[model samples]
Target: MAEELLFTVDGPKAVPARRISLAEAGLLERQHLQQWVIDHPELIGNGVKIVTFEFDRWVSGAGSAAADRLDVLGIDRTGRLVVVELKRDRAPDTVTMQAINYAAMVRRFSLDTLADVHAAYLGGSTTADEALARLMEWAEGVSDETLSPPRIVLMASDFGPTVTNTALFLYEAGIDIRLLRYQLYETAAGEKMLSVAQLLPVPDAEEFMVRPRSSSATQAASRKSGERRAAAAQRLIAHELIPDGTSLTVTMPNLVGQDRDAIRAWLDAEPDRARVRWYNDLTAPVEWEHDGQRYRLIGLIRTIIESATGKPPQAQIWPTAWYCIDDGRTLNQIADPLP
Candidate 1:
């Protein structure tokens, strides 16, 4: 296939903008892409949220390379890990398999580790607990247990048939992999512009693919969300992971600009879907105290998010908000640390 051309119209005079390699625009370095992605992950994929950049902390097993590095790691709204691999030009056929391998490695990353890594990425602009809270805000259901079966996103100027074919196969086989074509355009003023377009899993097809799962799967997931919250609460309190009466602080603020109408709509959607009921009453005790009030971690965050987003927390609030005043780790980190 032939490459597409781009132009800049300056008051009826159209000047051709040459499409070139990322290297030509000084964007081929790993950090160039990593930091840029860390700053603006929206450029990568839909609902993609950047977690950390330059993740390579894994120790090599028998068949793995010791120095393997993941360029950009992110997550989606659903909490699946997103492995973003950046290429300067045409993506090599091996990139897809390589990204899959990185996904396998990242599957082991704990919620705590992600928070710590994001802290380092932030260069101490904020506390790790705050970073974890923000991460939770970005990927609502993200937690140690929620991270799994990572997704892959390949970005480059073009893709050969082999890479696209492999990605298509993976997508159909239940692996969520996507291909993005990036074109680097140089304007007449020496400014560089980037165009990112989805290559595989066409948007309409993707919507069809992302439909509600089989009834069994849907029921199981809905049930799991509720059960997981209860189990985590029971395990934490019973095991004294975080002893009762601990004075916890809101690591982040409550959902400001809360929309009552959206909240009402969310509460009305999908009557049969199971969700852990939140303590709608602000006065109820949650087992953790803030200003002489007892509250459960999940319950408190749910109240906050529901007020803010008009939706049930669905484990979204647990690991993200609220931190121990003494230890500074978020509730979920203490309750569900990675093994």
Candidate 2:
């Protein structure tokens, strides 16, 4: 794939900005780039939300390796762990091996350990309970007892053939791996800019999704999720806590990437307007106020996501993604008090 070319529009003319490197721009790996990623994780991909920044606190069970630091730890919508490794320049061939080692180490992490790290990373900006709640919310329905293999993401100015080749091989072998090439550009006014691209996966990030297996366990989980939602909806309906036609605002969780931007833009364009309404159907309780179409809570979120991202979001718990416009209570929260 061709590298991206960015142009600045001066009145009516489009002028191309000269591409530069991190070195030329005088940016440090940890101080500048890494911190930027820690602040705004979309530099990697919006799908993978940052869990903690700069995790280095690891002790080898075998006592063979020294203290190794993972640049960033994240989790996707599907509950898989994301291990991000960064380099300021062209990545050395050893980055692939290093990222693999990092993934190996984190793959064994318990959700408790993850929550602890997240709480520490929050640095008292929020309470422990709030941090844990945020972490579990991002984890979706992934329980503490279950853990999935970590996905490796390598971000750098470029990757050599060795790294790219190994990434392709790992991906083909069913290992979740992605390479993001960081490009640097300088404008005519001497201002610096940066751009990142998914090199190996190349182009769109949504195409390479983590496919869930069709096992009996997965089927059972899906069925249980459906039943849980149905019961909650029924309880809400019975209690009259959410009367029919109760206006609702779609309450999105922490979002990143282009789709998130699209949704935010649409939402900020209309803050007071409620796009969703409560209906009488137990299986499908939410109505689109604009179109008058009824849909399940998950389906409404999915529709908005599909409209924004041009595809459905990864599987996640959606009952709490929206809330009452008047009371600001979620469906699950409203159902919690019902006897």
Each model's TM-score? 0.60, 0.60
> With candidate 2 superimposed using the best TM-score fit, by how many Å does residue 244's alpha carbon deviate from the native?
12
lDDT of 1 by residue, 164-256 (tens): 766755775567678888787899899888777887777443333333334455335534442323223333544655443444554442543
CA lDDT, every prediction?
0.64, 0.70
lDDT, candidate 2, equals 0.70
* lDDT top scorer: 2
Worst 10 residues of 2 by lDDT: 205-214
Candidate 1: pairs in clash: 263-310, 285-294, 286-294, 286-295, 286-296, 287-295
Error of model 2, residue 77, in angstroms = 1.5
Model 2 clash tally? 0
In candidate 2, what are the lDDT values of residues 172-256, reduced to their tens digit?
5557688998888998888888888887664342233343233455335534542322245656766677668878878666543
TM-score, prediction 1: 0.60
- Superposed Cα RMSD, model 1: 13.6
Q: RMSD of each candidate?
A: 13.6, 13.6
* Model 2, runs deviating above 4 Å: 62-65, 125-127, 203-339
